[model samples]
Target: MDVVVIETRPLGDRSYLVHDGEVALVIDPQRDTDRVEAAAAEADVRITHVAETHLHNDYLTGGLILARAHGAEYLVSANDDVAFDRTPMADGGTVQVGRLTVKAVATPGHTHHHLSYVVSDGEDQAVFSGGSLLYGSVGRTDLVSDEDTEDLTRAQYSSVRRLAAEAQPDAALYPTHGFGSFCSSGPASSARSSTVAEQQESNHAFTDADEDHFVRELINNLTAYPSYYAHMAPANRQGPGPADLTVPESVDPAELSRRLADGEWVVDLRHRVAFASRHLQGSVSFEYGRGSSFTAYLGWVLPWNQKMTLVGSEEDIEKAIRDLSRIGIDSPDAALGTDPSALAPGTAVVHYPRVGWAEMLHGRSAGDVVLDVRRTDEYDAGHVAGAVNVPLHELLGRMAEVPAGTVWVHCATGYRSGVAASLLQRAGRQVVHVDAKYGPS
Candidate 1:
């Protein structure tokens, strides 16, 4: 038997193709199905099965697409309440493909229906432990409800313990999600496989810590999940197609400006710090960090009719667009160039100047609304007097909460403030971005 692991970068997702002679199986396919299909063709093996661990809240799965195209059996955890035409695999059930045995393990912590699979070539076993167990940590419970969350975490603990006790120490382990993945609660590792014994000794979620400690740590480490998660579940339930996964072409700054003026949303895909420092006025700073949650967040914040433009390095344009598309926000004309000076008309360029205490006081007296777009934690650690707290990440979604009309935006250095300014300006508000590239001290 041969197993191949495919890494989907940026999203930090992984899919696998396991083959035994002329038979093949695919696990947790990403949005792009062409590559998986091509690989199967090259191997001259018939795709016998396409399996999903659970209903993902991140990217749309390609399991149905691959199944329909190849006449492969579509398998999912039996506990998934969402209706789909496929063979639901129960816990401990095994499916045979030539000499390979794919055993389903019910491990429901990340979601109520989540499952992990163990594969064997009649002898040695390799577990495709989906979201249940990752490199350093386990899947998060907040992906579902509080009860489900605790239940899944507890189940995950048992699942890992069982694998440690039953599976061989040298049995290869493969997971669906990794580092930079929103589904994972801990940092991902570069090392592909670790023995059951090694995980028993080293994996934090599996060793030394009690259940209560593990649950507390898991909940605390989970960052804000994207708002788009509310939409993803239903879309996956409906079994949507993967045809609309295309990136937007780069647009001139001037054209981008016109779109913003016409009520289009300008999304600056820079880091929060980069956006606050200097950016076009009225542009919302929706920084894309690791994982599928970014797409979910965009869906929650951005409307369908809103024309969108991306402000980032040229390399980031394609990725930004792809991330947006996963949640059904297909704004092909939203991409903008990276140069700050070339920003389209109506774009508010951020400027942060270093000045003395007296100069800072004078500027505030001159009537600039001292806009503070950092998180609550950053805001409490001493900020400009009279500045209002509006985190850059939540600015786009909470537009009504921001004071209308004209304002001066600033963050610690002005990176995120720039992004905030661009987003606000595109939203049809007037803004003057303060260039705080240098500290007041």
Candidate 2:
């Protein structure tokens, strides 16, 4: 069997397409099915099956629709109560793709009903460890609820031990969520691939540590999941439709005023630098591009009750709607992708100011605030000495907490800071963005 990894960057989640020249199996696909179809076309194999590890909470799954389009069987755990039609993959259940065999191994830890599939071409073997096991760690058990976390952590430990004992010693491990994905609890081992034997020797999951200690470490180390995560489970339970890729109706600048007055969302989708130069006064600046962290941050920042209108290039607007749909921001009510010169009278085109970190430090004052917009945990780990920790997601509600006068907004990298600076400027603060890029230092 040939296994190809489809990695979505920025978030770094992965999907896999395993084929044997004649038939293929797609595992944990994203909402955009074009890439998967293109890969299948290039491989010259008909897609025969699509399988999901569990009901995804991070993003919408394209498996059911992909299966229907290709007349392939869609697989989900028998223990899962799916809203739509699917073939239940009971533990030890087997499916065939041409000459290759795919067997489901029940591993319920990532969710209440997660599965790890072991594939074989009679002699050679590979394990599609969907979230149960990873290179150096396993899936986070706390995403479900506080009450279920410890039980799930123990289940994860037992499930991984089962895989190590049963799967081929040299079987390749292909996990769905360890490449810097928030679903994972620790850093990835190596970028490419590792075998069962290798993971056994080095992976702490296989060590002789006590289960209680492992659970303590896992819970203590899990970083904050975005508030947008709350919307994913219910959205997936209802089953999201295929993403709508059409450009929305372009409302007049006059209508935009009325919407803004009515508390609608007018998201500005330009680069941070472009948005900093000039933008519509009441609009929220959320930079959009090919590989931006737009979906997560936009979902985190945009008010759920407000009607939204996306502003960007036609190409970007199309892709934006698709990406947004994955996180249940299905339809933007309207759109406008033209020069801002025609904006309604006195719309007040605003500007965001910037300064380097060195300049910000050198010219610092008691009242000039250094606002850090990263997550609280990130801020706690190590931030610029006295920077205030107001994560960009919470900035809308916590604007009062920022000290009066000139505010200096920054994040670990500059992406989130750009967003924070825009919000502050829109709120009538004299803000200066810390423009230099830095990681966790």
Candidate 3:
């Protein structure tokens, strides 16, 4: 059997294309289908099947689209009551394509309906454990709900143990959430694949802890996930629309003004310093090439799948649109390369003051508030005393919670805080960005 690993580095999700001589299958594919199709073409095999372990919350899946396009069967956990058509799979369910034998194993930990697929050629096999038994740690159970966290975590322990015992120590372990994915209970061991024997020896969750200890460690370790996650499962359940890679039309000043008036987000994709110098009156700073990939970790703060206009250098529009498409954000209404002053003529523009951490500490008075825009867990780990904990993802709706006077914004590093500082300035707050060391030092 030929197993091709497709890593969507932007979102830290790994998909797999398993093929034999004449037929192939895809597992846990993200919205992007180009790579999957390419692998199949290279192997000279037709894609015969696509399987999803569960309703994905981290990003949209392309299973339905791939299945429709290829005239292949689509497989999903029978437990999920999705609206669309699919071959419902249960534990012990089996399917065959060419020489490959596929079997589904029920692993209810990440979600209530999660299933792990094992594809074997005679005695040799690999497990497509999507968000279940990960490389160094297990999947985060709390993504569904706080109440389900402990129960699912307990179930996870049993599930992993069962998988290791049944697959034997030698079977290859391939998981969907790895690399730098936030869905893992802890960090991945490496970007590479591992064997069940290797995980049994090295992984903390797999080898070291009991069920009670595992639950505590997992719950305590989970930080704030993306706000956009709440919408992903439902979107995937309904069956997502096809990939929209259309380069948006250039909007005139009047259209830009109308969209801004109608509550569309005008995101500035330049560096923070450039944005702070001068930008559209209400535009928010969201640089495309910041600390992380723009679409992967930080882009979830906005509405998923909704089209938003881009404001930045003319050269950046194409790359920005491609980045947004990875997470199912395809409707990039327009990209404006001109200066904000030129794009939104007669509209009021704004700017904010950027200060180093030391300057902020020495210069600001008690009346000036320090706003930490990192994750809640990051703030909890250690933060400057009296810093308001409003994560960048939750900032737009919680402006009232920020103090009235000067709001000094910061993140562990500077990228997130830069975005937050721009937002505060756009909201008419007196903003000071502590763009230097502000974490525990």
* Winning candidate number (TM-score): 2
Stretches of candidate 2 off by over 4 Å are 333-338, 342-346, 438-441
Cα misplacement distance, residue 171 of candidate 2 (Å):
1.7
Q: Mind giving the per-residue lDDT tens digits that candidate 2 earns over 262-281?
A: 65678888787887878777
Which of the two candidates, 1 or 3, achieves a greater lDDT against the reference?
A: 3
lDDT of 1 by residue, 1-441 (tens): 888777776566788899986989999887668778888878888999999988887677778888898899988877676566988898888899778988887777777777788888977888787787788777777877755666676777777776566567777778887656677775456666765566666788777468887776766666655566666667777776774645556677678767655666677777655665666655666677654244544565466446667778666666766666655566456455555557775575763333333444455545456667776757776777677888877887787877654667777655556556666666666666664652545
Whole-model lDDT values for every prediction: 0.70, 0.81, 0.82
Every candidate's CA RMSD: 5.2, 2.3, 2.4
**Better candidate by TM-score, 2 or 3:** 2
Q: What is the lDDT of candidate 1?
A: 0.70
Writing each residue's lDDT as its tens digit, candidate 3 over 1-441 gives 889988777677889999888899999887768778998898899999999998998888889989999999999998898989999999999999789989999999999989998889896888889998998888889889988888998898888887776685788889999677778887567738789888888887776567788778877887777767787898899998777765667788888877777667888788878887788877777776633557754466765555578887656777676666656677676746758878878777777788887787678887889888888888877888877899888887898899788888999777788888877776778888777766444
TM-score of every model?
Answer: 0.77, 0.93, 0.91
Which of 1 and 2 is the better model by lDDT? 2
Worst 10 residues of 2 by lDDT: 337-346
